[model samples]
Target chain A: MALPTYAGPLERTWYYAFRTICGLIFFFLIAPLVVIVPLSFNAVPFFTFTQEMLTLDPAGYSLKWYQDFFGNLNWHGAVKNSFIIAVFATLISTTLGTIGALGLSRAEMPMKTTVMAILISPMIVPLIISAAGMYFFYSKIGLAATHIGVIIAHAALGIPFVVITVTATLVGFDQSLIRAAYNLGASPTYTFFKIIVPLILPGVISGGLFAFITSFDEVVVVLFVGSYEQRTIPWQMFSGIREQISPTILAVATLLIAVSIMLLASLELIRRRGERLRGITPS
Target chain B: MAAATTSDGALTTADGIPLKASLARAERRNRNRALLLVTPLFAFILVFFLMPIFDMLTRSVDNTVVGSVLVRSVPVLSQWDDSSGELPSEAVFKAMVLDIQDGRETRTIGKVGTRMNYEKSGMTSLFRKSGRRAKQIKEAPYKEALIKLDKKWGDINTWRLLKRESDAQTLTHYLASIDMRFNDSGEVVRQPEEKQIYINLFIRTLKLSALITVLCLVLGYPISYLLATLPVRTSNLLMILVLLPFWTSLLVRTTAWIALLQKQGVINDFLVGVGLIGDDGRLAMIHNAIGTVVAMVHILLPFMVLPLYSVMKTIPPSYVRAARSMGATPWTAFWRVYVPNTVSGIGAGGILVFIIAIGYYITPALVGGVSGTLISNFIAQHISVTLNWGLAAALGSVLLALVLALYILYDKIVGIDNMKMG
Candidate 1:
């Protein structure tokens, strides 16, 4: 807000002080993430900045850590497993969650609150508890130490995001559009694909992205239920941090930060598009 | 088809059905369609998520280990009174010898010993030593033979332990989880001072989580207010500073903290370079409680800010202005008017952060070396390292109960539908 002309010196001083406090808080939120990028490129295999790097010598930075991450077979396997599990988990969670959100948004749905609570309980429960429970139960059913088991666990973890996001999108949806399509002689399936899907596509994509990230970043459950064969990137990073502190983890962290930036950008774009389509101006 | 007219002169459909019945049928069909769409995911969650949790809950009190291993002795021992100071009769010792022999043959005696060891410290070796000797006693007067083989066999408390643990269900694990145990007389008592860890751990977890939640709110409120009161274009650009970390991987942020907080890391180096501290006086920030609080406050700050911003955005700015125009001081207007209105956001964010921080595992494990580890770390240690599934499950159940209680409170206050992710 613009300062009023009648504002006193105290108000002016407090306003600037408030702004400065917020600026420092924002720096606290983002500085750690930004600091790792340049350190990831350090020529020495250390987490701290070197004298040469601080002096801006080109010799102080190198791509050796990136090379190590790419060339290592274990890292390769972890990357592959992460994508495969995340893709499958996202697909399952999105399909189920979208359909469930549709039902949840319906006026005629029974026991809506209880059903919603049950569907999203996966998100509410702590991950360690989930991991411990899955470890015990999956072992009994011969699902432990298998890729399929980790996939299913991750999918369950991802579903709540999909349901929440999709349900939110459906809140702004116009139901009359569906009736209009039906009255115009469109079949039920045709109405769904042509009218409903188009309107909620942004929500669905954003939800899918959420599900993907949840699965991709998940490590606790995989550690409990999966063997080395099912290790993911976070799992690798966890071990790397624990067993040996390496600059390669920094390189990987930088890449992951870049990925998150891209995802955040796309989610913003989709949000704007969804609002525009719904005829709601951005506030 | 014959038209059926209701006594109250209700309308009829063209198909000769009552109009209300037709409407009810349509409604029922819609309900079924909705339920049908939801059934698959519901069942999936039931099988995969809910069932496993229930299974773990059962493990907390599932005391079939001692009973199943000592099947013969349990039935025989049930006939004896444990309150009697005297040891069991020769027949009881006979049955014990047979049970231990069978258990040893099946290699299940160790499980029983491990379970019993949780109750009493020396039971594992006692069971092991007795198992090796029980097979050799092929004669009568088994009581003397067992006592000669191991003096622990003659102790009245040994028989009491057998009788108590023989039941198919026991609260021993639950009791042990809270740092209490059944003493020689079978009354629940607090564990010995040195052995009492879990209770302190539970308290520490709560205290640390509360501290983290308050820290997050303090750091988050000013930024959230600034973002909300700013023009939309500026706020949107500034929002990325919050959302970027929100969307970033938890491990990455934790790793970043490790890089920044470690003794030899960036923060310490900066301090040393600036001569704020001597080179030899670098702070032990990482691997301690300070590290956990700092890193977690950063990680959970966005959760606090996002909800606050959304709530603050809805509050009209004129309320504070109205208060100011009524001769209220600026601080009075802001605190008395604005802060009171944001209480719901505070509740939502406070409970959310506390709930999350209480159950945090990863960041704490990486940065919180010994003194800073929460209950979740102990639970993990039991599951993987100690192989104490029963204790792990009990600890987990306690944590789950806490989280669920807070969750119900959150659902009551904020409504779960309002829980928004980036």
Candidate 2:
């Protein structure tokens, strides 16, 4: 935390000023999440900013809402359905994207830019148009209200994230390594698994995490394709907010934020390991 | 080569030359593998995404409702386009009565009428109730029959609806989306000089998006610079905090802001405690432009931060140090050396936030009341509440064009070369 050797009086003043400014921005960025962490512990039903006292009030904190979210059948069902959809969509999108990234990045193909753009187009186009179109088509096929329908719909939305992340990782990839494996008489499949996959594993995992979260958070498409039983947690939360302002949503939101922070921490960890394993030094 | 020889032995010679002579064959095989890898994505997008959009766009010109069912009665209706240029011919009126009586109505004039009505109002029920009374046109006197229905029908507006029914190929929906309606001669006319129309909404949405983009740049630039200059460990931790909300469900984040911004929410509670305003004074947080700005800025802050951070991280400290060593003040050095370098991130982040903000449905829908509704909310209304795809598609198409236009404009102003998005 010490200032560098070249620091002068004015430079020292500027350093403190910069640090203070950065610290304030950091607080502002994290303040909302921080606010929710404490509020979730409030025992009272009303969601006031701070509890009764300035001191720590464990009496105001109870596990009732968390218990309610778990014990309630609707919340549990939605959570289960969200996990199911997110998992399937994640696997499908990540697999497809990884393969596409491998081919686009490694193959000596024509029109690579065109292919990459086409592959990444889903991310740019608005989902509402896609949702409207899918609703009509899926209705005709009688798949509009099915769980499979929503999963496929969400997977299409998530694919671009996987493609973007994996492609970026592939930019640093050493394709000759795969050729080296093949020269050793390892089959193409074996080389792929042992060589290419390991090198790009961080990108793949990070991309998969992004894909999973994208599908998990998606609401508009699910609203079009998913029915009551197929409702995910976001959709349930959406309806809950619309029907009434429930503090229980706050409890759920806080839990989700915590889980997201955990996931992000793991993703960052995976990325660091990935960079180290691939011998690609980070800034 | 050995793997290929073993795996594809049938296609290769003993000398390891493939049966195909040209590199084109290898190219073809590679292309096929590439195709195989990309096919799933293309097919998924095609079937689930593209096909549906095409179907929705098709609704724009789908005049089947008027073309098929009402063709038989048009002859009689054409006769009434005489002298007064108002009422339909008596025989056509009689035919409509019969058509209404038979209940096997072929034309979906009803659907068209309802579609137009949602973009405005007083259409479906107005038209449906009147259409049902065709039989009464014969029994009752013509004036009585007309009076019984909407008096607006007695006016020229009724003829306008009927005329819309008469046209087999109509661009009325497209025109209406731009807040234009067909004049009596079927020329495009602005929807009165007074009432706010879709054209205004289009402009408003753009203006609102631009305002938010500017707000984000103002709020995000300094933070991004600071994050960039900090030690990597500290900056990375800060960056994660910024990105933390992105991992949570967007719906949850928007609603959390809603809880915080509501009249009885934390913001209002704080304002009241501080005597910023009376308890009963307008919170004016949610359900207005203020709420829209707050929620959108929060949702989009990470987008602005990430790009700026990446750009700043790449920038060397020497530029600023040199500026300072040359007798420049710290602020001057920052403004001259650091700020210009960060413009690329600023532009990239601005575009990202603006485009995403325009299409936002949840935040605007939740926090923005009537005054703050964006174009997406109307698109949702068309598809879900009104079940009008033509208008929805037209509105959606307009939004798509606006976003695309902004992209090109941003590229022009900022020079896409400057962008170094991570």
Candidate 3:
């Protein structure tokens, strides 16, 4: 809103000042993210800007660190491991969580609130406790150090997100549509596949993406139950930071930052599309 | 005849089936379908999540090692009355020697020693040192033989501590987690001055987490208000600023902070270049509490903002305008009308931010140097480095309890079913 005419100086000052304060906060939010992009391209293996970089010299920027990150077999292995764990974990969490959401939205579900609290507890519990408990428990059950174990552990952690997103989509759903489709002589399975799946597809896919990201970003559990075979990107970065702040890490960080922006963009588009489909879009 | 016909009319379906039986079948089928849909995930989480948490809680109370190895001594020692303010009799010492020899032969003595030492300091060495020399003793004055091996054996308190901790189940790990220990005379007592570390760490964790929550509120509240008040076109563009960090890899953000806060990092270098400080006088920020607070506030600010923004969006601007039109000043109108409506939002955001901050692990571990560390770091140490799973489990249980308590509060104030993802 523009400044109003016939306002006192004090009122006008407060409006401008409020906007300025908000502007500073927005800058604070974005400054750190903006700061890291330039530093990742420094010619020297330094976190600070070199004189040459400040002067915009031709030799001031390099892709050597990016090369190092891509060329390292360990980094490649970590990327591969991350994909393997994240893919299986996303599939399990999305399927199971969608099913759970379906149950919870039903009118006849028993002890629905209590079961929901139980389902969401994994997200509420601290990572350390879950990791420690899983460490001991998995070892005893002969699940520790195996890919299947990490995948399952991550899937458990990711279920809450899936249930939350999918259940939200179900809230806007018209339950009558299911009955209407079934009344046309279509089977229950056919009605579900034809009606419900299409309506909830965006939520399902977005929820699956969230689950994938949760597993991708997870590190503490891997540290506890995983051996060398299960190191993901975050795990590698964690160890890399603890041992030495290699510039290659900065390059990888930059790359991950790009991935996050892409993910955020896709989620925003999915949300708008879902809202339109659910008949809530404003003109 | 009229009442019976009316009852028959009410109970029958249009298709001639009894309505009571048909409706009951439908309800049963719906319930079963719901259960069928939920069973796979319910059973999965039960095995992977709930069971492990239950297992960890039990570890806090599990006491099996000491009794298994010192089998003969525990019962005999229980019979001796150390309340007379003297060491147990010759019979107790003979039993102890026999138990140690039994433990040594089976090589379970070290395990027993380790378990006992967790209860009383230096007890493990006494056992270890005595086990080596117990083999040379071949006589009836075993009491003198043991006392000569270590003067600690002559103390009645040591024997009392031993007997009290020998129960097949105990609370030792939980006690240690809270920085309390059973004293020599067998009463729960505060740990001595130098040994009082865990309680202080717990307090520091709480304080730092609270500070981070407050910081997030201070920074996020105005931003959220702006996002809510602005036209949708501008606010939508500005929303990415909040979501960017929310979606960014946590490590990338943390690494950025490290690079910006280190002594040779961006902020320091900028300050030094601008003559704020000498090059040699670079400020220490990243590896301490300041680093932890700054980085965490940045990371968690979105959590506070998102909830507050959602709540504020629903509150109409007309309330403040009406209050203003009534001759109240803007500040007065805001304080009386606007802030009260946002209480639920504040509760939701504050609880969410605080709960997350309290259990934070990676940020503090990376940026928090010696004095900056939270309790999660120590929990990590015990789990991986120290190999004290029981103590780690106890620490974890306490942290989990804190989170769950706040979680219940959040649910009461803001329904857990309302928790959502962007």
Best by DockQ: 1
Cα lDDT computed for each candidate against the true fold:
0.93, 0.75, 0.89
The iRMS of the candidates, in order, is 0.8, 2.8, 1.1
Best by TM-score: 1
Docking class for candidate 2: acceptable
- Residue-wise C-alpha lDDT for candidate 1, range A1-283, written one tens digit per residue: 7788899999999888888898999999999999999999999988999999999999998999999999999999999999999999999999999998999999999999999999989998999999999999999999999989999999999999999999999998899999899889999999999999999999899999999999999999999999899999999999999998899999999999999999998999998898888788955
Give lDDT tens digits, candidate 2, residues A1-283: 3577877898899788867876776676666666666666667665556546235766767778788788889898899999999999999899988887777775665677666655665666677767777887888888799999988888888887888788888888887887789889999889988988888888888888888888888888888888888899998888888886566777898988878978888987887798677676864
Please give, for residues B1-422, the per-residue lDDT of candidate 3 as tens digits.
Answer: 01222344666665666667778999999999999999999999999999999998888788878788888888888888868877788888898898888788888888877877877679789888888888877888999988888999888888887888788778878888988988877778988888889999999999999999998998999999989988998899999999999999888889999999999999999999999999999999988999999999999999999999999999999998899889998799989999999999999999999998888899999999988899999999988887777899889889999999999999999999998767
Every model's TM-score: 0.98, 0.88, 0.96
Clashing pairs in 1: none
Best by lDDT: 1
Given candidate 2, what's the lDDT at residue A73?
92
Q: Which ten residues in a row have the lowest lDDT in candidate 3 chain B?
A: B1-10
RMSD (Å) per prediction: 1.7, 4.7, 2.4
| Chain B, candidate 1: TM-score | 0.97
Model 2 chain B: ten consecutive residues of lowest lDDT: B413-422
Encode model 1's per-residue lDDT on B393-420: one tens digit a residue.
9999999999999999999999998888
Model 3: number of clashes?
A: 0
Which parts of model 1 are misplaced by more than 4 Å?
B1-9
Candidate 1 chain A worst ten-residue window by lDDT: A274-283
